[model samples]
Target: MKFAVIVFPGSNCDIDMFHAIKDELGEDVSYVWHDETSLEGFDAILLPGGFSYGDYLRSGAIARFSPIMKAVEEAAAAGKPILGVCNGFQVLLEAGLLPGAMRRNSKLTFICKQTELEVKQGDTMFTQSYEEGESITIPVAHGDGNYYCDEETLKNLQANNQIVFTYKEDINGSIANIAGITNKKGNVLGMMPHPERAVDELLGSADGLKLFQSIVKHWREQHAITS
Candidate 1:
């Protein structure tokens, strides 16, 4: 499947994401500047991590207004999968595409390190390659990585199996140790960790490869392609 990695001014992980998809996953991928409004032919959308708009107005606050986000919203509405990593997660929240909000790390510091993450639900299109309850380590780098949601939303997330990944060691104090979560429709995922950075063996692990594979497998199944 083809993918578009959205690029915003201050987005630093766009290249990493493109490499993961194009080189590692062997998929058709391209960089889409944040100003372009039409995502007419992409099968999936990826929002990579970075200090978009220099994080000037709180993580993803300003970047949410990018012209391309309109197209992203339209894509999400059409049931195409969207994955947001790190600051991209912040933007999805600000754009109202995902649930919850992020706050300063409990320690109020930018924590950057490899961290353990447990697979909470492997049933979705983005996580099906992982076994249920599998443990994997991925790198995380951010100051506002803590996630919070209302009690009702939390309950719904639990009931719907939308909580996909949880930190095994509470590295950022996210509620329920949430490292990643999916929208109710399972078409959008927002997570704090950098999976793209961990997709290579030289990077210390290839656990993140399964997440991308899951998306491709799901797309092929939905489109009825044998390749």
Candidate 2:
């Protein structure tokens, strides 16, 4: 499946995402600038981590207005897989594509380290390669990674099985240790961990590669059905 790695100004992890998809995952991937208006041919959309617009107003706050986001929204509405990592997660929240909001880390510090995460549910497109309750290591780097949703939203997320991954420990003060979550439709995923960075064992882990593989597998299945 072909993928588009959306690049906004000051985005640093776009190349990492590209490398993970093209080199490691053996998929067709290309960098799409933020201002572009079309995403007609891509099978999936990836929003990589970085301080877009220098994180001036807020993490992902400015980048949320990028022209590409409209196309991203259309993709999501069309049931195309969309994965947003780190600041990309923040952008997703800002765009209201997924529920919840991010806040400053409880300790008020920038954290950079590998975090152990548990697969909350493995049936979704993004986690199909993983088993439920399985543990995997992925690196996270961010200062405002705390995730909060109202009690009603949390209950709905739980009821719908939208929560995808949770930290083994409270790494960033996110409610219920949520490390990642999918939209109600189960197509869009937003997470704080840098899965692209961990796609290579040489980088200390290859656990993240399963995520990309899962996406590809899902796409193939869907395509086969529709075609």
lDDT of 2 by residue, 1-227 (tens): 89999999999999999999999999999999999999999999999999999988888999999999999999999999999999999999999999999999999999999999999999999999999999999999999999999999999999999999999999779999999999999999999999998998899999999999999999998879653
Q: Cα RMSD to native, each candidate?
A: 1.4, 1.1
What tens digits encode model 1's per-residue C-alpha lDDT throughout 173-225? 89999999999999999999999998999998898989999999999999994
lDDT of 2: 0.95
Q: Identify the runs in model 1 with alpha carbons over 4 angstroms from their true place.
A: 225-227
Assess the local accuracy of residue 160 in candidate 2 as a C-alpha lDDT between 0 and 100: 99
Error of 1 at 115 (Å): 0.9
Among residues 3 or more apart in sequence or in different chains, the pairs in candidate 1 whose N, CA or C atoms overlap within 3 Å are none
TM-score of each: 0.98, 0.98
